[model samples]
Target chain A: MLKIENLQARIEEKEILRGINLDIKPGEVHAIMGPNGSGKSTLASVLAGREDYEVTGGSVDFLGKDLLELSPEDRAKEGLFLAFQYPVEIPGVSTTNFMKTALNEKRKYHGLDPLDAAQFLKLMKEKMKLVQIDQALLSRSLNEGFSGGEKKRNEIFQMAMLEPKLAILDETDSGLDIDALRIVANGVNQLRSKDNSFLVVTHYQRLLEYIVPDYVHVLYKGRIVKSGTKDLALELEERGYDFIKEEVDQAIA
Target chain B: MDVKSNLKTAYSQQEGNSTHLASFQTENWKTFSGMGIPALKHEEWKYIPVKNIFKDEMNIAIESSNLEDTIIKKSILPGTEEANTIVFFNGRFQADHSIIHEKDALVVKSLETAAGDEDALFVEEHLGHSQAYHPDGVNALNGAFASGGAFIKLKKGKSLLQPLIIYHFSDSSNGFRFSQPRILASIEANAQITIVETYINIGGGESFTNEVIEICTGRDSITRYIKLQNEGKHSNHTGTTHVRQLERSNTHAVTITLDGAIVRNNLNMVMEDEHAESHMYGLYLLNGNTIADNHTIVDNRMPHCESNELYKGIMDDQSTGVFNGKIFVRKDSQKTNAYQSNKNILIGDQASANTKPQLEIFADDVKCSHGCTIGKLDEDALFYLRARGISEKNAKALLLQAFASDILGQIEHEAIKNYIEQLISERLSFQA
Candidate 1:
């Protein structure tokens, strides 16, 4: 479903992602665990085609298409979603309107007929029930005065609406409580299918306990150093990322 | 007599001398020519440079014999079938074209005819007060050239079923023109009315509009005024609206400045009686090299009065925006609440905004606050929309529309609000 070859990216003159190479197939869920400055979010931003990040020497292929060559809108139309760590607070755009425009734009890109107002509202109601987001909240401006957990849940709600092929959860679980975490995880698990995949980028293993990734990878200094089963997340949580840094130093030496 | 003399020559060479200045008109002209167009050095006109727009000569259109019929039709409102409309061509009233039925609650006629009648006491009293409140030279110039002023008076305890639309059409095909149309409006107690005023350029050269409108709101009256300015690129406009709340009244006004080469609007509201309420909202979306400035002053002289103001600007290309809002609470004006906010979005690096919202409170028991924000479009919001498969252009338009909705929602007239919404959409879609 996704392939990254020597993904070297930078912001300004400072190199954030040195050389990242990752490969994941359909129906696979990958959890990338890293320290604070370990390029975890950088990888997500590069994959999502953020304009601020410059890919110095790398190539990203999503479903065998040149991802780096596409614009951000094209990247989104190609079924690539990035749930921002801190979702933006848009004051005037209502959540329902924003979501409807997004969904219809993506649908139009896929050559599908746009949903009418009644059908769109019906689908929104169903998705809202799945994520437990209230109807009144969707009527207000998107994240205008939302709480931390509400914003995170709203991101998940948007995910449920768009239903992207490759979902990149970038620190979405950081500000959520236990209840919201379970709800968000439940929504993601419900949307999971054999034809889709997820790249969960988080700093803690707490989110992994809920989402339960198929493979856990320790990323240090932009590169994924090790890959293992879910147990690796529990081990890393217990020992912390210092253990990974020591192992990396010893390996280099 | 340095720069002022040169300006006098410029004004005389363009507009020529008025032959009707035999009575009080000549006195007004002497008072006007004595003080040329106020420079940036003046206190009231400090933030605005008025000399640039009027540096050259501008002739008032003289040939009223040949007027374009299509220009008059195009200037009317979209769905104004029963409107009491007044058409002003080159700052002179076109009596043959204006239609004001006797049965309507509104009395629309020329200020010249209404001035000598005993029924026009309101017009006689309130005509020159705006200039008195703001004694700048440009205000005097408008008073001096007040050729064909429009008078609208709503009778006591009456509500107009239809709107009163005033169109100021500028035809400067011969040469540069200077047009001034004074407006006198008096809303009686408990009366409700909506007044829509706009400017139109029929044959464009260089046209300058120096207009003043005086409004007197009676006790418990409701008044709404909408000013829409989309003049030609060579047009320059300087408008002043001095509204007075004679008693406990409510006034809601929205000023939309969409496209203009040089536009300056001065709005002043004086709360004379207790329990008066005023709400002022403005939206200025300027593109190209256009410049728009809005300067407002709300004076709370009585007790328990409230006033709230919000002005937003979306500037692109090399356009510039300026907002200066001042709220003054007098010492005796206790229990007064005044709030003012100004926000501007600069789309390009070259686009700029100068916003200053000031509050001078002398009353200790009053609540007054003012704030201004000048920023670019939110990048995070832009990404959030674009990441949802929305095109970048549409995303920007959505964000801008949302930013403008706060002010647009204040339009009390549904048709006017819809008209503005469509205008904003068209403006956003036309990408230069």
Candidate 2:
């Protein structure tokens, strides 16, 4: 479903993603774990086509399409979703209107008729039940004065509305409590299907325990050094990323 | 000939017809010639190019207006269907074209008639009081030709059933049309009224409108005033709305400037009595070569008066925006609470925003704060919207609307507010 071959990227003059190669099939969830300054979020930002990140050398093929060539909106229309770690606080743009715009744009891209007001509200109500966000929150400005957990849940709600082919969760679990974590994880699990995939980028294994991953990779210094099953996340959580750093330094030496 | 000499010649031609106000007319015209068009070196006229707009020959269309009733009916502000409609064509009041919906609630008469007959004391006390704040030629020029202006008064202790909509239109088919419209309104004690002022330019010829509206509010009265300026790009406008609270009155004014060649608005709120409250809100959305300058003043003359002022601007293309908000707390105005803020967003490279928030407090027990901001649209906010599958254009419009909604939210009239919102959306959608 996705292919990244030596996806080297940088912000400003500082290289973040040195050379990352990853291949994932449909219906599978992949978790990339790393310490601070390990390019975990950088990799996610590059995949989502954030303008600030410069891809120095590499290729990202999503469903056989060159993903880097598309604009951010085009990438979104192509069924690429990024759950920002820190969702933006947009005052005056209500969540319902914002989601309606996205849903209509994506639907229009695929030659589908736009949903009317009642139909859109009905769909939003169903998704709100799934994401456990109240109706008032959707009516207010998007992410403006929202708690951290509410922001994460709103990201998940947006994902449910979009139903992307490739979902990239960039530190979405950092600020959520146990209850919010289960709700968010369950929403992702419910959306998981053979035609869709998720790239769960997190710093802790606690999120992996709720939504078990098919594969876990330890990323260090912008490179995914090791790949294993879900047990690897637990092991890394117990031993800490220092052991991974030592392994990387020893290998480099 | 120079603009001042041309204006002097025009003023001399009109002074001969007036009998009751001949002295008043000549005095103001002398002031206009004495002050003339202020140069750019002048502090208040620094960024404003008032001299350029007045350089050409401008003749006040004093000829009795042959405007149709249909024109006045069509020009009534939306949502004011039940309102008392007052119409102005070529700076002169069109009485036949106006409609007084409620007969006894208020009285509408010609400025001279109102000054000489009923409410003569009000005319003597409050007429041309805006000149105290704006002593420039612009203010005096409007006062110099104040004939055919409107005189509106609300009955004591009686609130109107609906709003009073004043429509100012410029029919400039003959030549470079010049209009001077003066309004003297008095709301009696315990009365309530909402006054809305909107403008329309009917002809293709270039036009300039200089308007001054002075309002006096009695004790415990509530007044809401809204000014909407959306004339075409060929028109230039300078308007002053001066409101004085006699004692413990509440006044609210909102000015929305959408488009014009050059527009200058002076909104002054004089809180003269104890516990008087006022709010001044404005929004200007400019594109093309439009320059919208909003100058507002809040004067707290007595103790315990509170005033809040906020003016915002969004300038696109090579448009320019200027916001100057001044708040004054006099020595006798102890415990006065005055707050003023101005914010602007420049959407184009050449688009410029100039903001100055001035606060002068002579009272030791006063709380006064002023702030101004000028910035470009937040690129991060733009990216966030685009990432959600909205097109770049839609995203930009959404953010700009959001930035403007705080000001747009001040409009109390539902239909008029929505109408202005539609115009703002169209203005914001422009991209080059």
Candidate 3:
């Protein structure tokens, strides 16, 4: 459902993602694990069409469409969802209102009628149970003064609302306790279907234990150095990433 | 004739017509002639070109024959039908057109008649009190024509359910129109009142409204004042809303400027007694070549006085916005608290904002803080909204609406607040 070839991206003069290539089919989950500053987040940002990072050389394909040519909003409308590492706090904009606008916008893009108030409220109530989010939290300003766990759960709630074909989870496990991690994972696992895919980016294997991935890829210095089954994540967690770094360095020498 | 000669002729014609305010008018006319129109070099009028607005030949003559009842009816704000309506046509108060529903609790009379009647002492003590702080030719020009103004008083210990709505209509169809509308209101002890001021201009010709509304709050009284200026691009306005809070009184003022050619507003809160409190809020949402300048002053004269002020601006296209907030803590005003903040967002490349905060704190025991910021919209917030599938245009509109919500929420009057909210929503093309 998604493919990236020779993706070379940089922010300003510093190169971040150098020669990244990945492919994922429907119903498959791929995990990208790397050490700090190994271009894992950069890869997610590039796919989400963040304008700050210039893609010097890249071609991304999503369901046979050139994804790199679309704007960030268009990409979102085209069923690409990026769960931010840190959700922005926007004052005076209620989460419910934000979600309503976003949902209607995507519906319009798909040539569908917007859901009525009753329909929207019903869908929201159903989705609220999946993420275990409170209605009062959604009524307040979006992410303004929200706790870390609440913010992540809100992100997952939005992901569920949009029901994108492909969702990218960027460091969603960071700053989350064991309980929050379990809740977030449960929500994601419930949304998983044979027609949808996920690219889970993380720094540890803790998140993988709850929502086990089909493949594990270790990124080192802007390139994936190793790929294996879900067991590789447990192996890396026990042994650390130094061994992988050493192998890549030896290969370079 | 030119505007200067025309004003001079008008002044001469009305020199001795009324003995009530003749000496006051003479003194103000002298001040206006001496200062002539304020030049750009004048510190108070540096950004606004008040002289240029008068370059065109203006008809300062008072004429109300062209104004029809239908026009007044159409111009009345929705949801304010039960309000006590006070009408002004070409700067002259139209007693025949006004309607006062709460006659027992409220008193509305012409300034000239009030100055000569039993309310003479009250009118004399409060009229032109804003001149002490402003001390400018523009303010004095309005004072020179104060005879055509209105006097409003809320009886002691009375609270009116319906607010008083003052509509200033300027008819500029014949030529460039210049109008001055002045009002002085007294809220007696333990009384409560809400005053709303809005402007309406007839015809496509350019119109200038120089207004002054002075309010005196008595002991334990509460006063709510709202100024809504949404006149067309051909209209210009300069107005002063001076409020004095006596002995534990409370005051709240909100000013909303939606559209104008060049608008300048002066809002002052003078705490004359201990434990007096006041809140000042303003929002100027502008597009096109509009210019909205707001100047606010908070003076803590007595001990234990408190004041809070917040003014926000959203400038789009070639619009310009300016804000100057001043807070003063007198030597004897110990335990005084004052806070001021001005924030602006520039949406267009050519849009600009100028903000300044002046604080003169003398009392060592007072708490005073002031801050100002001018910049573009938050890029992170914008991207966060756009990434949610909202169009860039809609995202901007949503963000701007949120930016303006802080000031809009300060309006306590439901109907007036909703009316202004609708106007702002349409201005920003924002829904929901």
Q: What's model 2's overall lDDT?
A: 0.88
Candidate 1, superposed: residue stretches over 4 Å from native: A111-113, A237-242, B1-24, B55-57, B65-70, B100-104, B430-432
* lDDT tens per residue, model 1, A208-230: 98888999988898788989989
In candidate 3, which residue pairs get closer than 3 Å at backbone N, Cα or C atoms, i.e. clash?
none
lDDT of 3 by residue, B1-432 (tens): 777888888777653645447778889999999988888899888789888888547889866556789999898888888999999988888888889999999999998888888998887778888999999889998889988889999999999899999999999888788999988888999999999999998987899999988999999999998999999999999999999886789999999999999999999999999999999999999899998999999989999999999999999999999999999999999999899999999998999999999999999998888898999999888888888888888889888888889898998888888988888878877644
Tens digit per residue, CA lDDT, model 2, B102-219 = 7787889888877677567677777878888998988988888876688998888888878889989898888788888889898989999989998888877889998999999989
**How close to the true structure is residue A165 of candidate 1, measured as C-alpha lDDT?**
93
Candidates in order have lDDT scores of: 0.84, 0.88, 0.91
Better of 1 and 2 by lDDT: 2
Interface RMSD of 1: 3.0
Interface RMSD of each: 3.0, 3.0, 1.2
Ranking by TM-score: 3, 2, 1
lDDT of 1 at B289: 86
Model 1 clash tally?
Answer: 2
